[model samples]
Target chain A: MGDKTVLYDAHMKLNAKMAPFAGFEMPIQYTSIKEEVIAVRENVGVFDVSHMGEFFAEGPEAIKFIDNMMTNDFMGADLYKAVYSPLCRENGTVIDDFIAYKIGTERVLICVNASNIDKDYSWFESHVTEFDCQLSNHSSNYSLLAIQGPRSEEVLKQIEIYPTGDFPYYSAKEIQAHGEKLIIARTGYTGEDGFELFCSNQFITTLWDKLLNAGVIPCGLAARDVLRLEVGYPLYGHEIHDDVTPLDSALKWTVKFSKNNFIGKEALENYTPKYRLVKLSLDKGIPREGYPILNEEHETIGKVCSGTMSIISGKGIALCHVEKAKFPKDKKLFIQIRKNIVPANYHTKPFITGGHK
Target chain B: MSNVPENLFYTVDHEWIKIDGDIATIGITDFAQKALGDIVFVELPDVGESYSVNDTFGVVESIKSVSDLLIPVAGEVLERNDDLEDTPELCNESPFDNAWMLKIKMTNAEDKSSLLDATKYTAHCEASH
Candidate 1:
């Protein structure tokens, strides 16, 4: 058995296929991954993302402390805006990728991957020696729900959860619903216009009921994974990990060089990438993790990190890491399935586009 | 509960077989399809391939993972389900009928004795659950 989120009973009632993920027994799918993915793309869907980790960083030096911890430029971030960054080690390898909401200069709410909660907290504690900031792990205190799609705004509007003014993309707002404080952010992993609501665990069931009553379909982690992959968004353990540097994972854009100093900036500046992450569209067969990539002569080149059949494109797609020098030049590659070498072509990522806000 | 036709035979790996003298039609059971969740692709073997019991015949891929299709009886493939090449989801939609993966001429007539009958297979599925 694994840890259960606040929506465990709700998922069971919905007859979801539950599976263990990141030490939590979470819902993998309700109906089907393809159906839930299409619902999120064409209509609207909600995900119980309460298993993710949340942290509160506060103090007079919180802003400076966060800027030093993350790769992105958090110093110039506007209030209520969320900045996506990878927390890296001093050796320039990634610790985890996270989204930090700059609620205020003295206070920031960070969302990190569920599997890295303990490690990330320890890393944060070890690095706060000189800063006058306090960090608290509030992962157990909150339950999160993401309502995503083109019609997400309408569903939230039915419940009167909208703010008074324009709520820009990648921004968060604190509002009151059902006599409880709710932080709704226009952010998601599906590459669709959506809002993520963070509420206290005690009130999450009630909020879930309200969303369901408003005709919102409940999606699961499986659908979210396919949606993110279709958008070419990277998952932590799959696309980037503790052994992978930002340069190797195609995350160089997140690193801000103009900053005086950060955890991985110095090492990143001096180091060259050893591997290149490439996207491939297969002619046939689904490319799965750890599947070997081969050249035209059947020489093993690299391995697939993430892959699935794109429901939109109707083709198998994958993100794989190849040695920088061994990157296929002819755009021709082969993914070695059990007994067959399936041919593929190098393709630009974000297999489907134009769905973001 | 999954559908189990009263006349067909079942294997421990959840494959069903319908025998017509020496010729046998093979397909995965409805229980297997439900467990796999949306079947996106079915890798069928060649029509002329010979296989023994427990040999991996092909693969059935869902969005979650891939499952090996285990051959239940020793036989030489007589015909393959060419329709599944264009629409693998037929396995999920109609596993017993339209998704029949292969028709094989049995090499060992006594292999059917090892398979469970409908009543026994139903009990086996219940016991596993």
Candidate 2:
């Protein structure tokens, strides 16, 4: 058993079937995963995402410090904007993936994977001596909620304090909900048009009730997994790891090579990756994580990172980590999925681009 | 009220077998389908394939996970379900009736005694949940 978030009791009250994830007990699904997924695609669905970790970097040198830590350009991007970037080791291997938000003067809010909170904090404290930024882990004091879907904006307007209703994707702003200031960001893991709320832990129940009363459906991790897979969003440990380089993980674009000296820059400069992440649609089997990937002739290539049945496509889909040499678009792979060798075709991900009229 | 015929034997793994004289018509329990949610694919063992008790006979692919439908008794597959190849959802829509996975030629009738009766199977499921 691990620590429970403030929303744990609320979820159990709603009859959410809880499962352990990142050491926290969270809801796997409140209802059928299909219905929850449909709710997000067509209407609005609220998710309790308190398990993700939040950290704050504030000081005179916070800007300069974070700019060197992450691969993506921070100061160059506009205010109220967020960028997905990988914090790398000096050898260019991604230590973790994170989202950086510029909230105010020399201050930035970073959301990291729940499992890496302590590790990331220690890393920052050890290596970040030159910069005057003070890093604080604020994960335990906050409750995270995601109101995601095409109609998320409409539902948001129902909340009295969110008057500046329109936020471009990847942007964030502060708003009040139930008299508590909340950090609202137009960012999501499901690749949908939505807002993520970082609010006080004590206010979760009121906020959840308010959203549900406003007709926003409540979803859980089951729908979250399927939704992320549909859009090919990578998970922290699933598709990448500390040993996985940005180029090898198909995240080369996330690494800004020309940026001033950062960890992992030297290793990345002369790095030659042998593998790349590729999306595959299995023609025969249900591809799953850890399933061995093979070339057409049954030669071992790589392994499946994530897989699921696509309700919208009526087909089996998967994201695989495969040797770049063997996973060209013209090549076919066999995913060994439990007593079956399902054929897979290398294809581009983001199977469904949301926010369409 | 849905067809859990009084005579059929049930396995905890959700497979049910109806013994017609000696041959057994095998399929998943209706309870299994509801729990699995949606069936997208079924990998039925080919006819003439023989298996021992607890052998992995085939696979049932659902919308979320793949389950290994095990063999309760040592037997040879007499016939495979052909309709499921085209309409996999039959397993979900009608697990007890239209979604029969295979017909098996029994190797030992005594092995059937180890399986649970309808009353016992339902009790087992209820307690597990």
Candidate 3:
């Protein structure tokens, strides 16, 4: 058995299939993966992401510490604005990817992957020696619920204190709901207009119950994986890893070379990526992680990192890291599906776009 | 509760076989389908292929993972369920009826004796979970 979240009882009440993920007992599906995924894509769905870690950095040197630790520069970022970035090692290899929110002038809240909570906290502690800041890991003090989909605004409007229409993407605000303090951020892994609510464990349960009673769909990790993959979002262990750098993961846009001396800046400046991440659509068989991607000559060129049968596109889609020079210019590629070699086509990312506002 | 008809023969790997004379129709049990989540693709074995007992005959691809379909008994493939190639969700929607995977002519009719009945299979499923 793994650690159970505050919403464990709620999931059990819904008869959700519980599975161990990132050291937590998480719901893999409530009814079915297909139904849950469609609910997020077409209507609205809610996910329990309380297992994710939260760390707060505050003091006079908070911004300096964050700017030096992450690849994305937050020099002029407004208060309550969330910035997505990759935390890198000295060698430019990603330790983790996270969203850093500027809640105040001297305070920042970092939301990290569940599995990297301890490691990320330790990394921050080690790097804070040069700066005068206090870092606190408040992972256990909070529970997060993500309401995502085309109809997410309509669902959130029922409980949110502020007008849902005014919240911009990558923005966050502290608000009160049902007399409880909650932090609402217009950010999500799924390619949908959504808000992630962060609050105390007690308030989270109440919010979850309220959403459930309002006829909002309760989704699980299975649907979340499919939805993120459909939008070409990179997952931690799959697309980015301890040994994979931002350049290799198609996240070069997040790396601000103009920033004065950040961690991994020197290594990243000299390094060149050998493999490039590309989106693929299979003509027949469904591609899976670790499946060998072959070139036209049947030579192995790369391997799939994430894949799924897209519920919206009605085709097999995959994200693969292929040899930069060997990538087919004609968009033709082949993937080894069991015994047979299936034909595929390479296309630009966000395979199904225009969903997020 | 998973439906396990008393008339069907079961394998430890969660496959069900219904015998019609010397021919046996095989499909995954409702327990197996529910465990695999959503079935997205089914790769069927070619007709006329002969396989020994426990040989891998096909593959079932679900939204979460891929599972190999093993032959429960030694038999020669007589027919494949071509319908599943287009609509694989039938495996999840109706694992026993419309999603029947293969019909095989049994090589050894005596193999049926080793298969479990519905009650024993249900107990096995309960124990594993």
Chain A TM-score for predicted structure 2: 0.96
Residues A246-294 of candidate 2 have per-residue lDDT tens digits of 7887787788877877678888889888788888886665777889998
For A1-357, candidate 3 gives per-residue lDDT tens digits of 999999999899999999999999999999988899899888899999999999989999998899899999876578778999999999999999999888778988899999999999999999998898999998999999999988888777775545334578888877777788878888999999887888998888788888887788999999999899988999999999998899998999999999888899999999989788989998677999999999889999999999988877878999998988787777578999988999887888577873777
Write candidate 1's Cα lDDT for B1-129 as tens digits. 999999899998899999999999999999999989998989999989999999999999999788899998899999999999889999999999999999999999999999999999999889877
Ranking by TM-score: 1, 3, 2
Q: Is the docking of candidate 1 incorrect, acceptable, medium or high quality?
A: high
TM-score of each predicted structure versus truth: 0.98, 0.94, 0.97
Question: Could you tell me which residue pairs clash in candidate 3?
Answer: none
Better of 1 and 2 by DockQ: 1
TM-score of chain B taken alone, candidate 1: 0.97
iRMSD per prediction, in order = 0.8, 1.8, 0.9
Candidate 2 CAPRI classification by DockQ? acceptable
Q: Lowest-lDDT window of 10 residues in candidate 1 chain B? A: B120-129
Off by over 4 Å in 2: A161-166, A327-329, B1-5
* Number of the candidate with higher TM-score, 1 or 2: 1
Best by TM-score: 1
- CA RMSD of each candidate after superposition: 1.1, 2.2, 1.5
| Global fold similarity of model 1 (TM-score) | 0.98
Global CA lDDT computed for model 2: 0.83
